[model samples]
Target: MFTRFRLASTLAEFLGTAALVLIALVLSEITPVSYFVATSLAITLAAIVFIFGPISGAHFNPAITFGMWTARRIGTLRATAYVAAQMLGGLGAWQLYQYLNDKAVPAQSVTFNTTIWLAEAVGAFVLALGITAAISRAVDSLQWAVTAGATYFVGIMIASTASAGYLNPAVAVGLRSWNAAYVLGPLVGALVAVNLYHLLFSPSAVPVKRKR
Candidate 1:
């Protein structure tokens, strides 16, 4: 059994992630939304922040979780729980996608070229930086929104290749049941991104007391 905060946070992560995947999947399926994919993800992330940021920080992405943990912003126990919840949420999203669509949704082919990997790394680092800065209050609320918008633009643009720009492993898991190939490289890429961000930006590559 989990504590109240942990339970609530897990549920929030699950629902929020599910909604994000659903919206992205639905939108991408209808029209050629690949162009606007960045905007769509940004909107989803913003809404998640509005809804669950106060609760669980709306991680939804394992890379972010891992990065934060590595940066010493989160405790070991809490980080473990967050990672588990994120994985479950991603699996749930995939299942729900199947249930709603009445078929395994065809996943887009995402590949890994050096350029693509670099793009993913950069995207992940930028997104993580934005998130960390926001959490640390280094950036104001308005700055958070601006950061989200810019991060999404950069992220989508970077990952707009055969690989659907997976900057997080949780996202890869969500898409894995549909397309497994998109999982591996992006996970590595995202981890690299987070490590780079920590090395460059964090005071120490260790956890500190989180603001919230």
Candidate 2:
């Protein structure tokens, strides 16, 4: 049940997600800089959140969308649509990266362990927590941009050793071809984060006066 106007929101998500993948893919191909490329991701995500927040809430990641869904910020069907659009963005980025990098970044099969999985979950939780705060108390695009940027900077620094730091499911599917850790860990973390936000910080409902 997408109205024509809502389609723009989907497109915004697509562009933002694809931009992240493209930037990450390109940065990863650079020598030496690839080792500490979280800055690139942080800057790009910050810019996207600032530019596209009004259009789509600047989700750009399925985990964030799922977090919002769990927190009842978005309806289920709309969240599904957003997720679909995000996957497409990832697919587009992967194809573009393959073409540009000559398939240099093939998806590797990971030997998953508890520690890596926990890293993904914890990173995603913190990332989602930042997103929740940005949405809940955002004064302007600048605040959201800062929050998203900081989350990526810290989260990637931690998660990179553990899971290649695919905190965004869009990146997991698009860049890493859907490894189990990339797929499940972030979603679980998003669920936990959203629930925690709901319990601890989300604004409570107020009773309304009935018709007089």
TM-score for all models, in order of appearance: 0.77, 0.89
Best by lDDT: 2
Report lDDT (CA) for all predictions: 0.67, 0.82
Q: Which model scores highest in TM-score?
A: 2
lDDT of 1: 0.67
lDDT by residue for model 2 (95-181), tens: 888987787567767666677788888888888888887887655899989998888787777777666787888887676654677
Which whole-number lDDT from 0 to 100 does residue 134 have in model 1?
67
Alpha-carbon shift of residue 177 in model 2 (angstroms): 4.5
Show where candidate 1 strays beyond 4 Å.
107-115, 138-146, 177-212
19-138: candidate 1 lDDT, tens digit per residue: 776666666567565567777778877777766777887577777777777767678888888878777877788788889889886655544456655556666666766676566554
